[model samples]
Target: MTDATIKTAAMLAIGDELLSGRTKDKNIGHLAEVLTMAGIDLKQVRIVGDEEEAIVEALDALRERYDYVFTSGGIGPTHDDITADAVSKAFGVPCLHDPDAMGLLSEMYQRRDMEFTDARQRMARMPQGSRHIANPVSTAPGFVIGNVYVMAGVPQVFQAMLDTVVATLPAGTRILSRSLPCPFGEGDIGTLLGAVQKAHPETSIGSYPHFDGKRFSTELVVRGRDARALDAAAHDVAAMIEALTMEREGAKSKDLGTGELA
Candidate 1:
C-alpha cells in the first residue's frame, strides 16, 4: 500500500454570471466529487467575476497554496472570456495562438463551412509552453501550465476535458466512506456525535437531518482513507448511539422522559 498523504487542490470558477446568479454554479460540485474520488482534497473553491486582475490574483494565490489548481469558465469564444489571458498574465508568460489548437479549429471551421475570423481565432490563443488539453466536445482546447489545469466552462466540455487530465495525474490513497441511517433527530444525537468526532480525529463525521412528518431521521456518515480507522470509528459511534438509546429508555421507564428509544 502506498503511504497515505493528503493531496490538496483548489478550484477557481471564473465568470460574472455566476456571481449575479444568472448561472447556478454546478461545476464545483462535480469537480469536488471527482477530486475526492481520486484522493485529492479540495481545500478551497472561489467564484470570481470576469475581471482580469481579480482572476489573475486568485490564480496566483491558489496555484501557490495548493498542490493542484483547476479553473473552469471564461474559455469561450466571446470578448468577456479572458481566462487564457489572465492565466498567462498571472504566470508572467505571453499568450500566443497554439499551432495545434489552430489546426484543430481550422478543421472544425472547414467541416462546418464557417469563416474563422480573428474573434474565432482567439480560441487558439494559449499561454506559451503550455500543453493543450484535448476537448472532446468543442474545438476550443483547454491547457495545462505547471500544476494549473485550465478547463472549459460548459459542463459537458469540462467533464470530457477532466477525463483526459485525470488519467495522467498521480493517484493518492482513496478515501472510503460509509453512511448509516438512524431514526433519531440531530438534537437527540448531538452530544454523541461530538464525542465520535473527538475520538476519531482521522475520520470525518457528518450528520444529515431528514423529516418524514411522523418522525425525524438522520443519516450519519464516517469517512477516512484508512479502512481500519474508519471501521473502528464507526463501531464506537454505533456503540455510543446504542448507549444513548438505553439511557433514554431507562429515563422514560421512570416517567422522567416520554420519548421512545431510537
Candidate 2:
C-alpha cells in the first residue's frame, strides 16, 4: 500500500427507527471497517430521522466537509422513504425515475411474477446525474451522486452495495496496527502510555480495558501508516507495561516484608 494522503469520509444514517431505538444499526460498524481497510478515514457519522429537512441539512454539511459521504436508509417503497428527494434537494438537482434503475427493478419483478407496482416503482427514483450502485442481494439499487453514495438500510444489501462502492473509491495509505496485551489496567499505565504517545507523534496509541472476571487488564493498540513508527511505539508500550508490572511487584514485596497488606 502507498503512504499517500489519507482520504476522508463521513456517514449519514437516516431513519426515525434508528433514533427511536426501534431498529438497531449494523451498517455503521461495517462501513467503518471497510473504509479503514480501503484507507479512507471515516471521520464522522451522523444519524438523522426520516425527516427530509434533517436529512438534507446533514447531507449537505457532510458532503461539503468530507471527501465522500455515505448515506443509508429512507430509499424504500414506503411513503416516508424520502432519501432520494432529500438528496436531490441537497444538490439542487431534479429527482426523477432513473431509467437504468427502473429497467433493473422491472426485470427482477417480472422474473418473480410480481407486478412493478407504483409503490415498488418508488425504488427506481433517484437524483439526476446519479450513478447506480448495483445490489447483489436485492433487486433495488443504490445510487451515487457527486461525492455522496446513497445505499440501502438493510444489513445484507448495504454490505453488498459497499463491496461494489469501495472498489470504485481511491485507496489511500492503509493504516497498520499492532496490539499488545498488558497485564496492567489503564490507571496503572495511563501516565506512561501518554508519554510514549507523545514521544511517537507518528503513531496513535490507544488503551482499551477489559475485565477477565477477576481483574481489569488493558490492550494497547498502536496504529500508524508507517510500519517503523508503529513498531517503535508498540515496543515502547510493551516496555512501559513491563516496568509498571515490576514496580507493582516490588511494592507488594516491600509491603509483605513489613507485614502490611499489599
Candidate 3:
C-alpha cells in the first residue's frame, strides 16, 4: 500500500463485568498491537455495560466512524450476552441462529460427548447475513456485519478471532516506532521536545517519565507511518537528549571550577 494509505479502527469493549472491575478486560492491548502491526490505526475505544441499548449505541457510532469496529465481550451463552441482538438492532436486521454455526457447534459438542443444550446453542445466533469469524479456541464463532466485528470477550478467544479478522482486512501502511532513553526529565527537555514535534508534523513524539527511587528519567518515543519522517523525528529527539546532556555536564564543570554545588 502507499505511504498515505492508512486504515483506522475503533474498539468497543462490552460487558458490565469489565466496568464493575469484576472481570479485568485483557483484550484491548492485544487488539491494539495486532491492529497496528496489520496497518490499522486504533483511534477510539469505548467500554460499555452489557445493556443492549448501550451496545447498540456504541456499535452504531463506532461502525460509522471507523473503517472497522471490533467488539469484545457479551457474545456468550449467558442471558446477559446481548451483543448479537444489539448488533442485529444496530444494522436493522434480525438476530437468528445460523444453520452453519449450529452444525459446527453441534458437531463439536457431539465429538466431546457434551449436550448441545439450548443455552450452548445461543452461541450460534448472529446478525442476519453476517459472516462467521472462526474461533479456534472455542468452536462458537464470532461474526462480521457491515463494518463491525462481534467477537468473544475471553482473551484467548478474542485473540484467535482477531487473527482471523485481520487476515481478511486490507492492510495499509504500517506505522513504525522507535524509543530513545533520556537521562534528563521532562523539565530538562520539555520545550525542546515540543519544538521538535512541531517541526515533524508527520510524526508523533511522546515523552514518558519513570523514577527509580534516587533518579528520574524519560523515554522519548517517535512513531509514524513514513519511515523517513519517523527516523528524522527520532534523530531530533536524540539530538535534544545529547544537547541536554552536554549542557548538564558543562554546568557541572563550571560549578567544579567555581567550587560551588551544581
Candidate 4:
C-alpha cells in the first residue's frame, strides 16, 4: 500500500433498539475491520435513535467532518425504517422509489412466491442523485449519496454491501501489529505501558488480562504502520515485562515458570 494518509470514515448506527439494548449493533466492528484492511481509517462511531431529525443531524455532521460516512440500520421493510428518507432530507434531495431497485425487489419477491406489499417495496426507495451499492446476499440495495453510503442493518446483507463499496476506495498505509504476553498482570505494568504509549504516540498499545491457572497475566499488543517503530516499541514493552517479572521473582525468592515471552 502507498504511504499516503488514509481518508477517515465515520459510522452512524440508526435504530431505537440499539440504544434500548434490545438489539446489539454488529456493523460497527465489521466495518472497522474491513475498512482498516482496505486502508480507510474509521475514526468515529455513533448510535442514534430512529428519529428522522437525529438521523439527519448526524448525517450532516459526519459527512462534513470525515472523508466518508457509512450508516447502517433503519433500512429494513418496516415502518420505522426511514434512513433513506432522512439521508435524502439531510442532503436536500428527494427520496423516490427507484425503478431499477423496484425491478430487483419484484424479481426477488416473485422468486420466493411472496406477495410484494408496500412495505416490501419501501426498500426500493433511494436518495436523489445517488448510486446503488449492490447487495449480493439480499435484494434491498444500498445507496451512496455524496460522501455518505447507506446500508442495511442485517449483518449478512451489510457485510456484502460493504464488500462492494470497499473495492472502490483509495488504498492507504496498511497497519502492522505484533503482540507479546506479559506474565505479570496489567496492574503491575500499567505505569510502564503508559510511559511507552506516551513515547510512541503513533503506535497503539493494548493490554488484555487473562488467567493462567491461578495467576494473572496480560497480553500486550503493539500496532503501527511503521515497521521499525512498531518493533522498537514491542522490544521496549518486552524488556519492561521481563524486568518486572524478574523483580517480582527476586522479591518472593521463587522461580516463576517460563513459557517464553513472544
Candidate 5:
C-alpha cells in the first residue's frame, strides 16, 4: 500500500430473500473489514431483489462510482437466477457458458457420478469477456468482468471468492483505527469533539455511545492512513475525554482541578 492512491469499492447483495426478510445478510461486514485490511476502502453496500433491471441499474451506478464492485447472489441453478444476465446487459455483452467454468463443473459432477443437468450447468454461465473467480468450496466458479466481480450469495462461498479476488485488486493506504472508551457522553463532549475534528482534518473521528441502566459512556474512534497524524489525533481525543471526565467528577469529588482543554 506504499505510495498508492486510495482505492474504493462497493458491495451489492442481490436476492429477493434478503429484501423479503427471509434471510439475514452477513457478507457486507465481512467484505468491508476484509477490504479495509487489504487497504481498499469499502464505501457503500446496497441490497436489491433478484430482478434483472434492478441489478443492472445498481451495477451501472456502482461501477461508475467506485474502483471495484462486488456482487453476491443470483448466479445459481434456479430459474429466477439472473445476475450474470443482468451484468452482461450492463456491460453490453452476451451471456454465455464459460468453457473453463464448464470444465470445472463437469469434472466435479463426473467425479461424483452425478448427471450434469442443464440446471446445474447454469452455474457456468458468465458474461462474455469475463474471467473466472476460483471457488474452492464449490467447483462452479464466479466471474469478474471489468471492475465488477459476481460471486455466490452463500457466506462460505462468498468468503472464498473474496480471498481469490484480493490479490487482483489495487492497494491503497492502510487505514488505522484507535479507540478510547470514555465516561463522557455525547452531550458532554459534542463541542470538544467538533473542535478535535477541526484540529485533525486529515483523520476521521466518530463517537459511539452506549447506555443501559446507570452510566452514559462513549467510544471515540479515530482513523487515518498516516500513523503519525493518527497518533497525534488519538492522543488529543484521549486527553479530551480525560479532561471532561475529571470535570464531571470534580463537581462531586473534592479538590479536582479543571483538566486540560481539548
Candidate 6:
C-alpha cells in the first residue's frame, strides 16, 4: 500500500525544555536512524516550545509537505501537554475521548485502585477520527491524526511509540550507504572528493573529519537508492583518496631527500 511517491517524513520535537537546553533531546537521533532503516527518508525536524499555536503551525506545514510528521514531547499528563489540542486544531477537528483509549486507561487505573482523575484521563483524549499508536513504556497511548503522529517526550515512551508507528508505515526504496575511510585531512582530498561527487550526481557524498589525538582522518560516505550507483560512487571515492595519499607520501619522501640529489 502506497500513497504519493518519494516517501519522505518530518519530525517535530515539542518542549520548552528542549528550547531552553534543560532537557537534551534523544528522540531525533533515534528517529533518524530508525526511519532510514525503515526506508522512510526523514527530511526535516523542528523543535517548538510547548505552545499550541506553534505546534499547530509546524504540524500544518510539515503534514502538507511531507508524507508523514512524527512529533515528540508535550503529550503527557501535565498542563503543558497540549499536543492533542494543538493537533486537533491543526486539522480543525474536536479533541475528544477515544473509547478504546478510555477503556485501556480505565482498566489500568482501576487495577491500581487509583481514581482516574481528569488530569490523568486527558491522556485518553485524541483528535477525532484518529487511530491510537500504542505506548509500551506507558499505558497512555500516542495517536495519529491525519499524517501527523503525536508522541511523548520521555525517551522510553517515545521509543516504544516509535516501534508501534513504524510497523504501520509502508517501506520504501531502501537507501544504501558505503563509507571510505581516509587517513588524511579532508582538505587533503576535498578536490578529488568534489570531482567524484560531480561524476555521480545521483548519490549524496559527504566528508566527515575526525581527530584521534595523534592524527586526523576523514570518512567519506556515499548514499543512494541504487546499489550500483552507490558502489560506483564508493569506488571512485576510494580511488581518489588512494591517489591523494600516494601523492602526499611521494612529496614527503622528496622533502626528506633535502638537496641530497643534485
Q: Could you say which candidate leads in lDDT?
A: 2
The weakest ten consecutive residues by lDDT in model 2 span: 1-10
- What RMSD does model 5 have? 4.2
Task: List TM-scores for all candidates, in order.
Answer: 0.90, 0.94, 0.94, 0.89, 0.93, 0.93
> lDDT for each of the candidates?
0.90, 0.92, 0.91, 0.89, 0.90, 0.89
Cα error of candidate 6 at position 230, Å: 1.1
- How would you encode candidate 1's per-residue C-alpha lDDT over 1-262 as one tens digit per residue? 2233777899999999999999998889999999989988898999999999999999999999998999999988799999999999998999999999999999999999999889889899989999999998987899999899999999999899998888888897888998877768999999879988999998999999998877788999999988999999999878877887788778778975555556
| lDDT value, residue 77 of candidate 4 | 81
Backbone collision count in every prediction?
A: 0, 0, 0, 0, 0, 0
Instruction: Give residue 164's lDDT in candidate 4 (0 to 100).
Output: 91
Candidates 4 and 5 compared: the better one by TM-score is: 5
Q: Candidate 2 lDDT, tens digit per residue, 1-262? A: 2233778899999999999999999999999999989989998999999999999999989999889999999999999999999999999999999998999999999999999999999999999999999988888999999999999999999999999999998788888999999988888888889999999999988899999887889889999989999989988888888888899899888778577543
Better of 4 and 5 by lDDT: 5
Every candidate's CA RMSD: 3.2, 2.4, 2.4, 4.2, 4.2, 3.5
lDDT of 4 by residue, 99-149 (tens): 999999999999999998999999999898889999899878999999999
Off by over 4 Å in 5: 1-4, 213-215, 254-262
lDDT of 6 by residue, 55-93 (tens): 899999999999999999987778999999999999999
- The C-alpha stretches of model 2 lying farther than 4 A from their native spots are 1-4, 211-215, 257-262
Model 3 global lDDT (CA atoms, 0 to 1) = 0.91
